[model samples]
Structure formats: structure tokens, C-alpha cells
Target chain A: MTTRTVARRVLTLVVRGRGAQGGVWGEAVLREFDETVTTWQALRWAAGGIRVAMRERRRRAADARRAGARWRRVSRRIVIGSATAAAVLAVLNQFVVTIAYEPSAGMQPTLRAGSRIIVDRISLHFGGLSRGDLVQISLPTPAGRISAFKRVVGLPGDQISCRDGFLIRNGVRVDEPYLPAGSTIDCRALTVPAHEVYVLGDNRAASADSRIWGPVAERDITGRVLVFS
Target chain B: MPRRPDTSPQTLLLFRALLADPSQWRYGYDLSRETALASGTLYPILIRLADREFLETRWEPPEQPGRPPRHVYRLTDAGADHARERLAAAAKPSASSKKAATAPTPRLLGGAR
Candidate 1:
């Protein structure tokens, strides 16, 4: 191709590719004298340009470093700000259930008889309770057994009972799918109280839930379990 | 090209290795095998170094016309300087060592405290 044609082609390529104008022109300058510049030639120019740029950058960086007093002051303020934020978050997590402990065998098999769990207590902050959600209630007493971990079997005034080892709710046999095989219950014919729940365990034979202590008041409910964690 | 202050140990090691021949681009698997770093760890550092302008990365077009590309990394001018500094720093011991060597020692009281 002719020199003018090649220049036009290169110009068109530069426009189409939208390359770095400085670097591309630097390469173009090499191409003007010869059809193609070897990788070494291009690299040599790049190295020289980079060395100059680096020197300038280093000078600017040194000036910034000399103004360390201002940067130190800003950094200290930022550190203090972050520490305060972390402290606030720690306090918030304590109230919102960062961890949970299984006090008894009330909701066994699924959550184990006495397994300690780290509850994501924030789950209930956005979403409400659902049936079959094993919940932990935060009580005022420091009895070391303040939280009651149990599965929710009934809602407010949701008629619930046991019939022939089957959970009967609202005149229909509520399916207890998670319950272990050959488990039985004799606690039958009970109406869930107002603002109270009819709770039970998958291990009906060895649970100390509503059957023993009666229904729990809604005010006692702390938060619903999102996961075993 | 800006100097990349690499905080990660893996990145510091990688920069030192690349300083030997920076223009010769190294592949991911080769770097991973040579550095003994997991693929997950190596790839992230490569990307982070590239982001900080310490390294330049490119995907080598596959030998076949329509095949997955392989990534390659090379040290930029800024990366080379930073790597040299890091290497020099690694070679030198801290000023604290001298104080430790000459500091007064406390004698044991009753052979126990």
C-alpha cells in the first residue's frame, strides 16, 4: 500500500478502535518512518515515557507524603468513626439475637435435644412468624433458661388439638411431616387462647411444651427462627 | 502508571517473581503452580494488582477460532518500581532489631514470678 493510504488506514483504525491517543500517536510516529516498528522499539519509547511519568508521579507523591500531618489527622478521625460504628453494631446484635441456645428438649430431633445455635435473629425483623417456625422467646428473668425454644403449632385462636397421635387443627388433621416414626400424643381437645399459641414438638413423647405448661402469651414471643444457625 | 502498595503477602511474592522478566507475560496456572497459591487466591490478586495499575492483564485468544481464552498478566512500569521497593524492603531487617539486640535484660526474681 502507498504511504498516504497506510496513514489513512491507520487513522481510520485509530478512530474505530478508540485507542489511547498518546500511545497510539507515539506508535504512529514510529510507523511514519517505517512500515512497522519492532516490539523492542515500541517498548523502548514506552520505557522512556514511563520513566519520565514515574519521576513526576514520585515527586507529587513525595509532596503528598510531606503533608502527612493532614492525612494522619483525617486517618485518626476515620479510625475513631469506624470504631464507634463497630461498637454500635455489637450492641445492636446483642438485642437482635446474635446467638441462641437450646434450653431444653422441647423442639428436639430437628433442633436437637440440647444444641446451642447462633440464631440470625434479624430474620424476624422484616418477616413475621409462620406456623412450624421454631422460635426463641427473650424473657426478663436471668434464670439462665429465659429463652423458650419451641415449634409454633397454632396461631391466635387457631383451634388445635391431638387425636390418635395426629395433630388436629381447625377440624382437620394437620400434617406433622417432620415428626419421627411411631411417636404418639394423648393431649387432645384444646382451643388456642386469644393472643396465645398452641405449640408442640416433633418428638411428642418427650416434649415439655403447651401440653405441660399450657399456651404461651404472644407478648412472650421474641422472634421466629429463620434457620438452625 | 501508579505505584501499587500491595498489602497482601501473596501479591508481594508475585511482584518479586515478575521483576525477573516482567515483559515475559506469565499464565495463571504457571503462576499458581510456581507460587503454590490456590487458583482462587492468585486470580483475585492478579485482578487487584491490575485494578491498582500495578499490573496489565490480557486474555490470549485461543489457538482454536472459537475456544475459551486464557488470561495473562504482566508488570506495568509502576508495578516494576513497587516490586523493586518491596524486594529491597524484604531484604532489609527493621531498626527495632538493633534495639532488641542491645536492650537491657531483666534478671529472674526467685527464679519465678
Candidate 2:
């Protein structure tokens, strides 16, 4: 056989081996070898084809490493972002304020049933409760502790009475515009002792409040209603 | 697979040749001949350089009939700059500790005399 034929046979074997190994570029390398003018040059081209195969293997490995690094960076960012969002929500719930739903119409004109209200827990730290401010009070019950919303009608050391269907505070008639039209509250005279406040609901007839359970302690007040929708 | 391209003698020789004409496109066979590198050594270097973006490639159609097309390569602008900086850094000693290293050593004055 001639030198050119021997070189072609060697290159064909090499190309077939590369193809079996999944090196798709074998055809391109074989084409380049076929164009070589001499047998020596063809042998050299076959050697270059093996190097090309090795190069492709290295390139694939590098690409895999880069893809893994990119995925790790993306996962890290998601974790940090979620943690930051959760932290902001926790701080808002504890130190700032939160939304509370009024489930009953006990406070009627002041706060209707099914109304959404913003309860400001932070404001209580700066000031004491005043008469007529709507407050949330936690009362012990047989089932568990239940929270109730009502208006502060009398403060510590004040005379309070609901006589003849009208409220009297400190020997004077108390004007409560929030009461529904023609609503009447009839109860016996009672004095608000120290560290306690008299509370009443605007819907007098339907409310279960201080009139039934007596005055609530000042410490039972949790927050005051800022606004409602 | 090597994490980085091997800085063998042939690799540096090929780099010097490519750096000489950074803007000009050169063929593979021509580079192999100029650098006296075997196809086994030459192609791996070329693939590594291209992978690192230190070289760019394109295909050139045959100038005559029956001759197959071939790939050509050239260094990009950033590639050339990186090559220049790396070569310069390799050629010189680091300046950070030069002053301390070259300072005169303390000696006992006239004690042995």
C-alpha cells in the first residue's frame, strides 16, 4: 500500500474511535485531514484530532463548574431575601401595630361588626388611658382569655352610674354621641376604684361588658383603636 | 483536565506569536509550523486560550475548489490587554516587598576587630 493510503487508514481508525466516544467534531477534523497534501501532514493532523477531543472534555467540565456556582449564588440570594422579609414582618407585628377584625357590633356606631381596625400597641408606652378612648381589654373566661373592645367611660377614683337609662360620671351627665339613637343603659350606681376603669359598649342592650362583669383593671387594656374601616 | 492552561514552553511560544499580531487573524497549521509545536500540543493550547476568551475563532472558506474550510483565530481587545498585563507581571519581581528585601543587613560595628 502507498504512504497516502496507510495515513488515510490510520486517520479513519482514529476518527471512528472518536466518534464512538461521542466527540461530534470528529467529522470536521477528518475533513481537514483529507485535504492534507502529504502523508506526514496527515499523521500530524490525526494527532491534533486527539488533542481536540481532550480539549472538549476539559471545556465541558469547566462549564459544569460554572453552572453549579451560578445555582448556588441564586439559592443563597433567595434564602437571604426570604429571611429579611420575615424579619420585617415580625418587627411590625410586635413593636409597631397590627390589624384586628371586630367580630361583633358591640361598639356599634364607633366600630361596626366585621370592621377592620388598626390597633396601636406602641402609643400606650407614651401616655396613660383617658376616658372615652376606645380600648381593647383582655378578660379571663372559662374557655380562655378573650379580648373585648369597648369605650372607657370612667377612670380610676371616679363615680359612675347608669340611672334612668342615662350615664352619669363624677356627678355630671356624660354625653356619648357614639351611642345609637334611642339606646338606653339602665344600671345601679357604682364607683370606679383605683387601678381600674369603667367600660361600656355603644350597643348597650346587646353588649356584655363592664356593666355585667364590673370595671376592668388598667393592666387588662392591651391597645387602643387608631382607625377602622 | 487542568484547572488552568498549562504554561509549558510551547504554550508561551504560541502566546508570544499571537501577541505579536493581536489584531490579525492566523490559521492553526501556520501557528503550529511557526512555533514548531506538534499538533498534540498546539491544539490543546489553542482550545484553552479560546475557552478563556483570550482568543476568538472564525471559519474561512477554501480559496480553491476541493479544499476544505479551516478555522482562524485572533486575540480580542480584552484578551490582548490581559496577555500584556500577565506577561509584564511574570517578567518582574513583586514591588510590595522589594524595599524590605533589598535593605542592608545590620552588622556588628568593630566588634570582631
Candidate 3:
């Protein structure tokens, strides 16, 4: 082939190769440069997002540190206050009392079975028991047992007895509004002991109180039933 | 000192992964796998962390006589402390919206006399 024809063929191959690769020489260079620039741009955008996130995180951390310190201070104050209150309550629960208990199922529907009660043990301590107050006393424990609980129906210097399911205290037929169903006693009449209380259960038939165990001493009394929970 | 694009997040995350295990030397591919970044995105971050003195990088021992060595990275003491700060920041709530969401209030009111 002629040298000129050979040169023309070579030129055509070069053009075709450039065309297949999809660029002019300068365009190819510019495209590569653009790609490099775009990659860096994407990275820069990602880094910017990361920077904002980091800054926000830093601010939040500072705020939380301050808040945590404040909360700790508040908690310390609360702990101190609560501890002082608890100490006062403990002293009262030890020296003075404010709770009551029933000996048996005396006032069933009104009080209930196995129900413990909180009494103003301090109230009875100041002003003594009247005609009918549900009081608790430490009865005679037959050598080896704990104290007992009962209701006071008659006080010292009173004539106490139960006739036909009704209580008679000091020549008058007393009305007991707290009696449960089927309460009946066999005692006729007896003189109350000096400085002692004649106690009985609201359910006279089921109770083993002063009628069986005799009158209770004044010092053996604990308190009266006030609140039921 | 052209700010270098504020690479604190990547630096912090890299420091965390490194401090979580100080004895083992982590490479670029290991860090990329742990942090879920592509090679194109991760290599530059590694280079930046190394430049900041937050990370130390070295050529790892070759597995065989003729095998290419891997580049390993680890966090410095300052880097670990910065990571701790970043982690603390990450654990905190971002705005008042979160506080409002968590605060409790009375559900009912007593009748007005």
C-alpha cells in the first residue's frame, strides 16, 4: 500500500478508537478530571454531614453533664430530707403507738375477720377510755404466751353483766351498736374490779375474754382501734 | 490548615473501634468493615486521622515471603479520650423535643368546688 494511504488508515483507526472510547482527547481528560472532582465532592458532602452531627453531639454532651450534676444535687437534698423524716417516724413507732387489733371475729361485718387496725394509741393515753371503747390489753398469759385483745364494756366501780344477749352496765341496759350476729353470754351479774376494765368481745358467744379469763389490769392496756385499712 | 473538611465523626468512630481492642492491630479493610464504609470513602479518612496524630499507622508484617504488607491503624491516648467525649455526646438527647416526650404529668384532676 502507499505510504499516504497507510497514514490515512492509521488516522482513521485512531479516530475510531477515540470514538469508541466516547471522547475527544481534551474531552477525555476533562471527563476524568470531572470524575475526580465529583468523587471529592461526594466525600466532602459526607464529611460536612459528619461535622454537623459531631457538633450537635458535643453540645448535647455538655448540656447533659450540667443536667446530671443538677439532678445529683437535687437527689442528695431529697435523700437527706427523707432520712430525717424516717428517723422521726421510727422514734414515734418505738416510744408511742397508733395501731389497734381485734381479739376475735367480734364485729364481723363492720370490722372483718383477720383485719389489723391503726389506732390513735396516743389519744387514749391522754384521755382514758369511756363507757364503750374497743380497747386492747395485755391479759394474763397462763405462764407462757403473748398478750390478748378485747373490747371494754364496763369500767371500775360499775355493775357489769349480760342478760338475754344484752349488756347491763351500772344499773342501765347498755346498747352495743357494734355487736355481730348470734352474740349471747351466760354471765348474770358481777362487780367490776377497782382500776380494772370489764372487757368482752362484740361476738359474746365466740369470745374467751373477761367472762372466762377475768378482768384486765389498767397498765396491761395498749390502745383502741381507730382506722381500718 | 484548611480545616480539612472536619472529619471528627470518622475519626471518632475509628478511634472507638481501635480502643475497643487495643492489642489487635486493625487495618484499613478491617476498619472499613467495622464502620461500614467503602474503600473509596475510608482510605482518605484513615489518612486524615493519621495526619491529626489521633491515629498511628504502620506497614504490617507480610503473611508470606513475597506477599504485600497491610497498613495497620490504632488510636493514641488523646484519640481514646476524644472518642470517650464523642461517645458521651452520642448518648445524650439532641433537643427539647426528647425531654418533653419523657416528662410525666398527672393524668386526672380533682373536681373544682
State TM-scores per candidate.
Answer: 0.38, 0.43, 0.37
**Which sections of candidate 1 miss by over 4 Å?**
A1-95, A122-126, A138-145, B1-113
lDDT of 2 at A168: 91
Write the residue-wise lDDT of candidate 1 on A1-229 in tens digits.
6554454445334322354332322232222222224544333333333433334346546878878978899999999999999999978875576567676676767778567676656655556567888777654356554777778888877887778777888989887778888877767577888878777766777777788767787667777665563
After superposition, which runs of candidate 2 have C-alpha atoms over 4 Å from their true positions?
Answer: A1-31, A37-40, A87-91, A94-229, B1-24, B33-36, B48-56, B62-69, B74-113
TM-score of 1: 0.38
Candidate 2: clashing pairs of residues: none
* lDDT measured at residue A197 in model 1 versus the true structure, 0 to 100: 78
Clashes of each: 1, 0, 1
User: Cα lDDT for residue B39, model 3?
Assistant: 43
CAPRI band of model 1? incorrect
Candidate 2 at residue A161, lDDT?
86
Better of 2 and 3 by DockQ: 2
Docking class of 2: incorrect
Which candidate number has the best TM-score?
Answer: 2
Q: How well does model 2 score by local distance difference test?
A: 0.74
True contacts kept of 2: 0.42
